[model samples]
Target: MAASHPLLAVRGLQAGYGRAQVLFDIGFEVHPGQVVTLLGRNGMGRSTTIKCLFGMLPVLGGHVEVRGRPVNGHASHRIAREGLSLVPEGRQIFTDLSVEENLVATARRPRTDDGRAPWTLERVYALWPRLKERRHNLGWQLSGGEQQMLAIGRALMTNPTLLVLDEATEGLAPVIRDEIWRTLATLKQEGLAQIVIDKNVKRLLPLADRHYVLEKGRVVWQGDSAALHAQPAIVQQYLGV
Candidate 1:
């Protein structure tokens, strides 16, 4: 079901590294069960917006809310505890831990109110049987695709209220990327909220409920996929399509 209120909201969000500002007064939102895409070319502040959302960097200004509560300056761990899980740019699985260990390391009980079955180890393995076969393998032992699966499974194990992926399918084989996209579709069907950042506009447009295009640290365009589809010129101009 669509949320009456946004599950995640950012308003006039501003952030930077030292003296170099990356995000301006940018804003966007993700309601429950909605798949929203953060669209932009490299260095247009898409990642920076995500960093601010998860409290990886300090919020210079603006309101950052999760589940209708202000969380502007909270720590990353604090943000995670509030039910926001992020699959970062790199597949940052713990290199030393085994796949099974990694999945359980940050696991949290699923929320019962959502009317969805909580993700479990068995369920994750079912989603990707390769993971079940390699359960005892160290994180560093998995291929890039397997590692990406592990990263995602780890987040799912945490049972987040909102799952955010930065560069969701970057640098993976086409087959693996298809699997990832398929899994995302399944999650969306199950009513899990997500915000994905990927460069494939053709694929993303159909998967996402809404889209936000960023240009030079500002949100230049925002609309539903159909609206964006109607304006190919906009995609080509800002996204270099």
Candidate 2:
């Protein structure tokens, strides 16, 4: 089980590609078992935030804490070992690896006080039956949705305390998107904290307990789902296409 405090906390985070800053003092918190959505239109630094958290991009300022431990300066692999998992924007699975291989490649047994083990291959296959059917298929052989499922399953294999997903449902079919959302909901019930970045504001509203809106690399708005729904104009001003 996750600890009683926030699983992930990012404060005044500043990061970007060399000589090209993309995030400016961005901040958010994902409490234990809570689902938080990072909302914004394209080119709004949402992906940059994920990259910084995962150590893919260098941090120009601020701190990233996992379970109250500062991780902003850690190496990417070290961060992973510290219990942060990321399903990156492009579903970047190893194209040469098979479904089962992909899952096994990232599998790690987490030590929790509950004594319940982390995800097993059997459990992951059960959670995503389509993946079981495609167990032998290479990553390049699967469709977009299948690849997305594989990405998620691979992350779950890490048994992370915090899961960060960039573009969780971008360019997938409706059915596949629904599957991803349902899977996330189930993870929530299982007490997996997540930070989701996606464009489906309406759908994400219900899935996420709170919403953070980013604009030009800054968090311009933060509120609960109810507040967001009540102020569609805020969406229009900052997020409307």
Which prediction has the highest lDDT against the true structure? Answer: 1
**Which regions of candidate 1 deviate over 4 angstroms?**
none
Candidate 1 per-residue C-alpha lDDT over 1-241 given as tens digits, one digit per residue, 9 for 90 to 100: 4667899989999999999988899998899889999999999999989888888889998899987899988889889988899999998999999999999999989755678888899989999999999999999999999999999999999898799999868999999999999999999999888999999989888789999999999999999999999999989999984
lDDT of 1: 0.91
Candidate 1: residue 24 Cα off by (Å): 0.9
lDDT score, candidate 2: 0.88
Q: After superposition, how far is residue 109 of candidate 2 from its true place, in Å?
A: 0.6
Q: How many residue-pair clashes does candidate 2 contain?
A: 0
Tens digit per residue, CA lDDT, model 2, 1-241: 3347677889999987778888989998888778898888989998888888888888899999887899887899889987889998889999999999999997887846433357889989999999999999999999999999999999999988778898968899999999999999888888788889888888888878889999999999999999999999999999888
List per-prediction Cα lDDT, in the order shown: 0.91, 0.88
